[model samples]
Target: MSRDDRQARRGYHHGNLKQALVDATLELVVERGPQGFTMAEAARKAGVSAGAPYRHFKGREEIIEEAARQGFEMFADLMEHAYASAPPSALARFEATGRAYLAFARKFPGHYITMFESGLPIAQNSDLKRTTDRAFAVLTRAAEELIARMPKDKRPPASMVSNHIWAMSHGVVELFSRGQPGTKTPFAPEDLLESGIGIYLRGLGLIERDD
Candidate 1:
């Protein structure tokens, strides 16, 4: 077989080549930052010829987008379950959704990295955008419920409230969950997130501060 024929053979090497490419992309995103690796390297990692990846993905961007898309889907599911399964209180369910974010990131570092750090513009991919919106909507819904208890004059915009918590959770994940994890600290990431949210809510008078 000519070299091109061998490359073609690699394209047909598996029944699930697309998933293999996605898996390889995830691995590479963690090992080397998303921009650090090339599609050829991903194909090599997946044990396929350089040309084989094109059969499954247009380029590295598509592979990362797929990883991010899957990540958002899983994230939305976890957040939905958390929001649904918590104690029967808006605060409880809202807090549960916050916890779920941490759990998902800790459990799926590769997906986490790909989804948030890959720098791929998810909004361009309709499916990826929808999944991401789903994940975010969980937080937005929780924020809406939590803020509804306050007077309309005092209530923060739901999007701002949700984005605030989202930023806080992301900060905790990056600093404690992913970055500077080995550094000595008195608090775990969960504690930090919980306390951070508590403080923010208290400042907004959304929650009564303990005397």
Candidate 2:
């Protein structure tokens, strides 16, 4: 066994050490963006020795990457719950998912930024790719349901619609919801998303009467 493993075994709270390290990493990400600290710093923050993080993570990159993975998993759950709680209308459900996306970004700024802005190569990280795909699948499923309710001739391709909505929602969050520097819009992020999506759907002849 490695020396780090030996030390971990000797520790009183070995079982919870991984979670403690993750928690500490998140605190650091919040204080100083995702790239702000080193693995040793995260270990120190977690109250472990300099070499302790290696017991759970390969290095600093892996630590943040794992955090991003967890973020995506939580994000998927939020989207699923939002869709499930919405009214019967497909449009309503789709809107709810969009709102959930924005809400997640607002509530979990550290996770949101790391998930999107961390610059991690998703293709190289199987776990990250899988979790991200699951989160995206929620949006795609919602789009498919919405398109199904439309007239056969009016329905756009589900994939195209899903991508469009995802792009718009992401743009809105990146520009307005996160309080980032961008065009100063008087409308709230949710309001902006609602209005923009409403217009886009109308333009596509997807919905006529706004119920």
lDDT of each: 0.87, 0.83
Worst 10 residues of 1 by lDDT: 3-12
- Pairs clashing within candidate 2: none
C-alpha-based local distance difference test score of model 2: 0.83
Please provide TM-scores, in order, for all candidate models, with all chains considered together. Answer: 0.91, 0.85
Candidate 1: C-alpha lDDT: 0.87
For model 1, name the residue pairs that clash. Answer: none
C-alpha lDDT (0 to 100) for residue 30 of candidate 1: 82
Best by lDDT: 1
**Tens-digit lDDT track of model 2 for 93-165:** 8899889988998898878877887899988999999998888888888889988877888788888887888
> How many clashing residue pairs are found in candidate 1?
0
